[model samples]
Target: MATPTAVVVGVGAERGLGAALCRHFAREGYHVLVAGRTAEKIEAVARGLKDLGLSAKAVLTDATVEADVVRLFDEAMSPGFGRDPSDLVVFNAGNNRQLDFRELSAEQFEDFWRVGCFAGFLVGREAARRLVPLGRGTLIFTGASASLRGKPGYAQFAAAKAGLRMISQSMAREYGPLGLHVAHVVVDGGIDGERLLKNRPEAKAARGEDGLLGIEAIAESYWHLHKQRRSAWTQELDLRPFKESF
Candidate 1:
């Protein structure tokens, strides 16, 4: 049998959830494609996995672009190196920022939508087009709490994420019967990752131990989702810190 392959898009810092997912899949003997908009970040992640004697390579992908999304699937479906086409794919591309609704410009809203919703749609569509034929595959989407709730000063992010959630739901309904496993993960609470730590150094201390979501812990849930049996497939899963309120 050819080696199994996994593709993770929106990978950033090595300490982030995306990188953690790559590492976990690599450890499971899957050839991982570390894809992201930043060449340096993705390359670093791929290099670190290689250093650990795992199979992974960096694929520079701007998930928001149509052509880039198409190209990413092209590479995933034709992965050589004695590996099978990607049977696992994750669309983790998105950004969040608090912007007052009254002051939010059209450009800012569109930017958020393009990244969080449009990109996910593009990836989902391509995955359906390719993986549906094989009759088996896993496509996971990384979502935020904003996907379900609209908080003040976060109109743009909430709108975009809510749309993404809808995309995942529709895909799951349309593809589950076709043997494509589509799931959405709603990540609640702040993640204990490089972005949060670097931006707000005090956040870790404020949240306390286990207060913030651990990247590895989050990645493990994704692995479980991929390993789930069809009879008990989960269309949506939520992860959050124990201390988190709802």
Candidate 2:
């Protein structure tokens, strides 16, 4: 039998969730395609995995661009050698910031939407197009707390996330019976990753042990979602630290 393959989009720092997912899937014996905007970051991730005796390759991709997304799927669906086309794919591209509604520029709002929502749509649509015909595959989207509620300075973020959530929902309902497992994962708290810790050095101390979401732990959930039985598939799952409030 041919070896399986997986594709993880939006990979960045080695310590981030996207990298964690790549590591986990590679460890599980899948040839992984690490896709992200930064050549250095994604290449480093693939090289690191290779050093650890795993199979992986880096594909430079801008998730918001349709052509880039199509090219990525082309590689994923036709990974060379004995590896089978990717049946597991993840859309984990997004950013967040708090800005006063009164001062937020239109460009800023559109930028956020382009990355946070538009990118997910492109990935989700491509996944549906490719995976639905195969009659088997898993496509997961990384969502946020903003997917469920809007806060004072998070209008743009909330709108983007909520839209992505809806896209995931629509895909699940439309394709679940056809054999595609579509899931949306709501990450509800500060991730214990480089982005948060570097920006706020005191975050780990403030949150206490396990107060922030562990990157590996979150990745484990995604793995489970992909492994779930079709008879009992999960369409949506939420992950948060024990101390995080809803």
Candidate 3:
């Protein structure tokens, strides 16, 4: 069998959990596809991986764009990447747009739907079309806590992510019998990085003695779910800090 290819969409050049996912999978001997909106940003991340002598490539792609999404997966299934049908596809798109719902405009709501929900649906649909015929593959979503329940101030964001969770369950039920592993992850714990420092400086200072969950650890969780046999499959996984309540 050919080596597995792992494609991660909406990757980041800065401190991103998805970037860490790329590294972890590559280290495990999977060809990594680092995709994002900007060519420069994608190239920078892919270069870092290539420098480490790992099998990784960067593609400038907008996950929200149908053409881009279709083309990216099509290329991944090509001969160059050794596209094993059983390879993993990690859907890690969307970013939090801080906007109060009381003042949330139609544009804000539409933007959230487009980036968070629509992109995921399109990506998942494309992957299903491509992988179903191949017999088996893993579809993973990197989600947030709000994905489960709607929150007071985070309506738009929560709704969008909730759509992804619903789709995950639907896909899992429909495709699980066909050897497809569909899993949704709720990463409730805060991640440590400069972004954390920039957003919550006080939290960072307080947690100096106790760090947040590392990206590599999170990646391992996804890998664990992907590798689990049907009898032991985890349909959903949620991770929160030990000190966290609720």
lDDT of the candidates, in the order given: 0.94, 0.95, 0.82
Query: lDDT tens digits, residues 1-246, model 2?
Result: 788999999999999999999999999999999999999999999999999999999999999999999999998898888999989999999989999999999999999999999999999999999999999999999999999999999999999999999999999999998999999999999999999999998999999999999999999999999999999999999999988998
Candidate 1 has its poorest 10 consecutive residues by lDDT at: 93-102
Residues 39-140, model 3: lDDT tens digits: 887787788889999878898889889999998988778736345643689898876756777799998898888888899998899889888887688999
Clash number for every model? 0, 0, 0
Model 2 residue 158 lDDT score: 96
* Candidate 1 global TM-score: 0.98
On the 0 to 100 scale, the lDDT of residue 118 in model 3 is 90
State residue 173's C-alpha deviation in candidate 2, in Å.
0.5
Off by over 4 Å in 3: 81-86
Off by over 4 Å in 2: none
Q: What's the lDDT for residue 151 in model 2?
A: 95
Runs in model 1 deviating more than 4 A are none
Pick the lDDT winner: 2
State candidate 2's TM-score.
0.99
The 10-residue segment with the lowest total lDDT in model 2: 74-83
Candidate 2, 81: how far from true, in Å?
2.0
